[model samples]
Target: MHQQLPPEQLDRLICLEARIHKKSKEEIIQEQFLQIESEKQTDENDRNKQNMDSNKKSDDLKCSQNSENSPQKLFTSQNLSPVQKKSIITKKHSQQKKKKKTKEGQQKDITQYLQYQKKQQKAKKCEQKLMEYSIQDSPFKNKSPLPSDPALEKQLKEKQNQIAISEIKIKELETHNSELRETISSLTEQQLRIQDVVKQFAIENEKLKKQQLQVQLQTNRVRLGEYVVQREKTALVDVWIDGQELREAKEQSKRLEVLKAEYENKKKNSKNKEEQEMRTLNVKLNFLIKEEQQLQETVDRLETEKNLHIKQLKRVYEEEHARFTKNNDYPLIGERYQVLSLLGKGGFSEVYKAYDLQELREVACKIHQLNSNWSDHAKQNYIRHAIRENRVHKELNHPHIVKLYDSVEIDKSSFCTVLELCDGPDLAYYIKKYKCFPEKEAKLLVGQIISAIKYLNNHKNKIIHYDLKPQNILFHLNELKISDFGLCKVLEDDNSKLQLTSQGVGTYWYLPPECFHMGDQPPNISSKVDIWSIGVIFFEMLFGQKPFGQGVSQEKILKEQIIVKSQSVTFPQKPIISNECKEFIRGCLAYNQVDRLDVHQASNHPYFQKKLN
Candidate 1:
């Protein structure tokens, strides 16, 4: 709309957008058809029911009429119908089938429980008898014959002496029984405390069980509804097919008869009318074709003009990427340091290649959005970014990570991030230039991002790369560096802070499922959201186009596509670079987040595995 892009691209977009609109119209038509079919089905059912009622009424009337006109016939025991008996027997059979299984199961469980109880009783009785026998036999008898062997006798004597000493110690301990009882009481108190913890655990377990039960019940209800709808839809489809075939055949016969009659009865009049109509239609068709040719010429001229404008936009955008390409000549804006070019821009700030005369070195300066003085929330968030950027960079000294030079106080009035400039195109621009990047190149870039993510996550820093598109990845001297932490939230860092936000933050075409369903905004995205972004990148690398087309209203576009044709889930409209690549992309973009591979698993994927050096 702004004409920032070329006119031809815009025209193509307009045409493509029209096609999408047509698809949407078709979907509306389909919905209307479904509604009509439902109404038809309802009407048919009502008509059939009415017909049956009418037929029953007629039969009743006929029976009454016959009974009145003639003498009433006597009924006998033979009045019982065979159909009624068979139906009764069938019901009885079903009842017996169900009841017999239940009865057998109940009887088995009863017998098992009774046997278990009897075994417990027997054990108690045996234990009681054994204890009584031991009590009665104790002091008055030698329970066995004395050993005759000299060594055995000596061992026995020693054992008896040890036992006596043990008995004396036991008696002494009994004399100090109050102290022992106090110790036992302390232990018992500890045991009670442990039991209390166990009881708390049990209560928590019960609560979890209830929650699980509710979830399971809801799942069952949904599944049941889905199955019923599917079954009904299948039945209707079959009926529609049969009715369509029958109607076509009948209509063909009727048309043939009509045509035969018309040809025989009104041949001369019909011929004159047809000749007149053909002459009129030919004139109209000639006029329409002439108008269409003129419109096509106008469209072609516009296409050329639009392409020129797009080329201009691409040049401007590439100039920004080129600024990052000139790592040595970073120039800042507004002071003695003229901002040579815009390096990159994000939701928060624009990065510039700035020159510091005093330092006499090129530094990548991030111009703060606060210079314009936005809202308090904006300031706080930028402050958080500055802090996180500093802290994380200071702690993490990975070679893959872009190095932070300093957070300089410019003119004692503003803050600018001075970073070590890297001379390479970002992955987004790289892929755009190359169309679909080779597997080796893609994985090499991905591995670097993985290294950076792992470093962040491993530091117990919960700074998920909330925006992990290819554009954010800079390719510097064969090393990929991740940039832009504007959307990052510090979750499990030393701060121990929690945030719940649902604002659309990342690029829409590359959004995850959570971002899609989390409403009109991005959700309080998890690390899993990064995983989804990775999936998008994975697809982008394998295909020139994104899984969802590059469109402003792509969210809505994809939503429609998913609604009408879920099975058409695919990569770019262009042919695939590889099947393995497609599978890899698909695995990452699984609708169920749990089904997707984690970063580690993804890195080792067969498609990527070969590319890993």
Candidate 2:
């Protein structure tokens, strides 16, 4: 008896059995003829059974017993009637003829059908084997005995070996199919990657082409710009040439007009010579008579004024002499500053050496005396000037500028300004005592002055020392400091042009040419005016006298005629003074303020440069 097997294993066994039992081509044809004959015999048997219907049931029982005895005796297509067989044969033939046109599709369908049939046959065989085993184990054991043929046993072993071999082959084919599928998937992925690379190359190429176009455009623009510039330059040259031609033509026309006017004037003079001479003499005689009368009145007035001034001077002298004989009457200033001694006295103010009680330091106090006889406007003006001076001194913080410690109004009319006290004399006194300064010393002092002035000029609150002179420049511990901002002008932030006040406060000898016109209209002055004064100071330091002679009357200086005349006078031939120093003075003393050297330029002059060495 055969062992029972699972459906799947049995299916594999059936397939192996079919392959092992496969016959030759001639044998296959003979088997097909045998199948047809079996169908015809089955049909005859069916007819006979119908004729013997009474015995058909008994025959069926017998047939069932036979099929149980022999498991191979099962129902199949061979058991069909001749008519059904004929019909199936005809249908198969038609299908084969139709499928012949699609041979590959028909072959795949036939292979799948064969495998399904093999599976069905294997399932039937498994059921038959199970029934056989059940029969052997049944209580009716004597009903049938198992077949004990050695040939059958050998056939079963051979079939089992074939099944194992077929299973191994099926596994190998499955592995090969899986490997082929993986290889196909890998190839597909690689093809997709290659397509992406190609697309990227195309995109990059497009960008590169766009960049090349932009570069070409920029190059064209640069070339066009150069061409435009060249055309403009050519046009400008033509315009300049035209301007030169027009200027020459205008000059010629002006000369022609002047010549024509001269010719006409000469004709008129020739025609009216005697009449003009007679008229000019009469006019001169009348002017002389009027001038004599005016001179007489002026002389008379001067004499009267002189007598009155003499009497007033006598009275003042008498009073001062009497006071001096008694004692010095120094007004008590504020309590904060104790007056030690009188420093100096001016027309409207008095300076005294004092000690600051609060800070315990020596200071100079300048007391302004507002006289009762002064007009309200004059008093206000005086007070305003003092306040401006105080403000400038307080704001300035340079080492070479005097510092104002404090300011106090002692009474309703008088105010005092406490200032830094200097032990040494003023520049004027030093110059008077030494006669002249050495070039090196003068340069150093002048450099310091320039630095102080530069600081004030460049300060946030810009100030200009309009009245810079020797008397206002002081010395302390051999260091020069500029003091007395009484006439300093604070410049407005927006306005560049400066106008001088009506009262000319600066010394006449040191005053610039513009300062002399203060009576008519306040002249627009600038830092260059201070440079002119610095030049005069420099000249006086070198020569011990002013550039214009000290004997030159103030009236002449105010008229500015002396400045014009002094420009022509050659400097005194001194071996100590170099030509560079003379040139420096000339540059600073230029008659036109515009032509004069500014403070910055004067500070950089070679004369000062030598002092650095």
Candidate 3:
């Protein structure tokens, strides 16, 4: 493989390495840039030709050879001596193979041609037979034409005239024949002398025939030049699409990095500006305090003099605070997130219109920070969660996990978790808006989601998602990512022993039966708990309902149904679902943890219909 690279590609690679050493990562890919550019030009030419195919102006050249003995003409114009043909072609738009004779069609045509020739031969044979029969039947039949006309008198006159003309013509012909015979005799003598010359010409002819045969042996195979050219063009097109994509990706990456740098600088400037303003205001306040203190020492002498100024300043401060609080609707806003509005709310957490404030763009920011309303327990929980979120996200490198820009612990108990806001609605909201997804698409979504979970499951310090349900999961474009890691617990690295609790913390509906029934049970299970939650989410994605939800009474709903009877989950009858998909849902819905589909096997389950890939 190393030896196979063309010289140009190897050169590009050398240049690329040099550029890398210079610390500029943005350069044409060493391995493919040369190939891509070369192929790009070829593909463009092919595409132009393909577009003209409608006008029927294609390269008229076609494959024309059959038997090894029959050598056809080769275009010496191109000097295409190689066995294989090359052309500027991409995509599968190869020239249509001329529909050659199928065995049946060939046989039919051959039979027809033979029959037509036989009819002509048979007619000639019949004529010869009649001629032979006529001669045997009547000897005078070939003698002369009958004098059948009103020309008996004219016949005598015509005979006399014909006699005279015959005599004159006969004498002339005899004289000419005598002279021709002498010339023939002389020519015959000359021909004897030229026998060697005739023999030499024959030898040259034979040589030419042999040369033709040799050429056929080498190039006799049918060469579909036009077809091949089209195929090359098609292949080149695929390569070009791939190359253009690569180029665009490189550009996008460069732009993203630039934007991130700009954003970081802007944030720094904003902070500095804020700090300067605060410091200046603090200095003024200190000056006022000092002046007040100086006046207070002489207050008894001039108490009434300071009263009006103090009252006016107190009113001004109250108005300013009120105006600031009312206008700032975001906790994570740096310089972005003026629009798109607030979407939803949380109990301890508030979803805001805060910008992503990372790179060149903005996304929703899920800012979790300490506030006056949170209790001491909540505050302690937020602190651990903030630390955990930062640690977990900082380590992860996946598409599904929300990106973390910057994490900051403000004051003693407050912290903010900056995140990338997704474009799509939550799975629950999507289900409500659009009742059911197209079957294959739904399977694809679940497959990606499960795959992300599978990644986390295998990752070091496995993420134990204490909370796993549809609400916490966001359907961001293609991926169904598990979000809100506030309740998530990362297991110890070397001793990754999980501690599960009967003290149900996550979404109750999605909680596994084992967690629900752990009253006297020892420690719960590992991250397998999250697997069950994912199972619940999968079931809901398909069936559009939690496993157990029928009764009006809370106890009847929780205990009287789901755990014992997992069969209550039903699907809408009119919908079309393959048997494979139904089986996956059933497996996921199993009550016993041991009877469940583990992340490893579930991803490749046939119920996916191999549609996920």
Best by TM-score: 2
lDDT of 1 by residue, 372-430 (tens): 46777877866776777666665556787777766755553356766767787677665
lDDT of each: 0.59, 0.67, 0.56
Q: Candidate 2: TM-score?
A: 0.46
Candidate 2's C-alpha runs over 4 A off are 1-332, 518-521, 553-556, 559-561, 564-569
Stretches of model 1 off by over 4 angstroms after superposition: 1-339, 356-361, 371-373, 411-413, 493-502, 519-524, 552-569, 572-579, 611-613
Error of 3 at 587 (Å): 1.8
Which candidate model has the greater lDDT, 1 or 3? 1
> TM-score-based ranking, best first?
2, 3, 1
How does model 3 score by TM-score?
0.43
lDDT of 3 by residue, 54-75 (tens): 4453243342333222334444
- Which pairs clash in the backbone of model 2? none
Model 2 / residue 113 / CA error / Å: 99
